[model samples]
Target: MVVGLGPGSPDWTTPEVREALNAATDLVGYTTYIDRVPPRPGQHRHASDNRVESERAAMALDLAKRGARVVVVSSGDPGVFAMAAAVLEESADPQWQDVPVRVLPGLTAANAVASRVGAPLGHDYAMISLSDRLKPWEVVAQRLSAVAAADMAIAIYNPASSQRTWQVGAMRDLLLEHRKPDTPVVLGRDVGGPTESVRVVSLVDLDPADVDMRTLLIIGASTTAAVDTPTGTRVYTSRRYHRR
Candidate 1:
């Protein structure tokens, strides 16, 4: 079974995910996510570093095929830029085709972050990952340009990482071409974790240096608005409606 841990917050982990983890004889995932799972008495944990998803998925499938209940874990919703796709892709191999696999969903970072801010995603939006590790920078750039041209709110994942630094700035500059310099942008880091923070800024003021692997960037649409209340500022994309 593949399960999403839903960030590192205990409050965000679903009961179904907990049940899977508790019953699994083996768990496989990246070192960070695997560490999130407590050491179960009889369960074996196979932890690998970043970018070894295929090997990790194969391990889980092998364990399941051997009659062991195996759980493959991802940080957020497995289907959203996470391990579920990798596992499903690997399962297509004839050797692992018969292994029964179940994927349990969890809250993705986009939704979590969007909720923290008012509702930047309430209108038409697109989710894109800025990571060029799997693809090319040119491809990502084209997609960003197209999405910006469409004036869709964008939820950017993996905006900046240790090795890749320029994409986030490039994204901001591209969006600036189509969006106002003062367009609201929300930065969500360590979302749902104890140290989680959500801050709003402008497109021109957004600094890629402030973002890391765990941060998610939300570039609001042209219609997105921000209002300051006594308590704090709230941002949302107005859902246009005409009263009859």
Candidate 2:
């Protein structure tokens, strides 16, 4: 079973996922995700680096084959750029053909972040990962350009990290070619975590230095609007599109 733990908060974790974790005899996942689950008696955890997803999937399958009740944990929805795909890919192998797989959904980072800042994704939107580790930079750039030209809201994941720091700025530049400089951009960092912060800025003011792997960016469409409420500012894309 592959379960999503939601976005770094116990309140965000679903009861179904909690039940699966309690029933699991062994847990296999990235070290950071594994550490999120409190240790319990008789349950064994096999944690590894984040980059070894294939190996981790195989390890979970091997454990399940040996009569262990294995659960693979991931942050956010497991099917959304998370462990579900990796496990399903590994399960296609003839060696693990008989192993049964189940995926449990949880609140995705995009939805969690959007909720914190009203409905920036109220209309058509695209979700893209800025990381080039698995795919080439050219492909990433092409997708960004296409989405921008289509005038759809965008949810960007894996924007930057210690090793990768330039992609966000490049994205902002490419987006400017198709979008307005005053386009609303929402930055959500560690949403649901203790140090959580959600703020809005213009596209031209989006600095790469402010983003990290933990940050999720929402770039609004041409129809998106930002209104200053009594409590705070709320951003949302218009549900009705105007005829061009």
Which residue pairs does candidate 1 place in steric collision? none
For model 2, which pairs clash?
A: none
The Cα local distance difference test for each model comes to 0.89, 0.94
Model 1 weakest lDDT span, ten residues long: 235-244
Q: How close is candidate 2 to the true structure, as a TM-score?
A: 0.97
lDDT computed for candidate 1: 0.89
Tens digits of per-residue lDDT, candidate 2, 84-163, equal: 99999999999998899999999999999998889999999999999999999999999999999999999999999999
Which sections of candidate 1 miss by over 4 Å? 241-244
RMSD of each: 2.1, 1.1
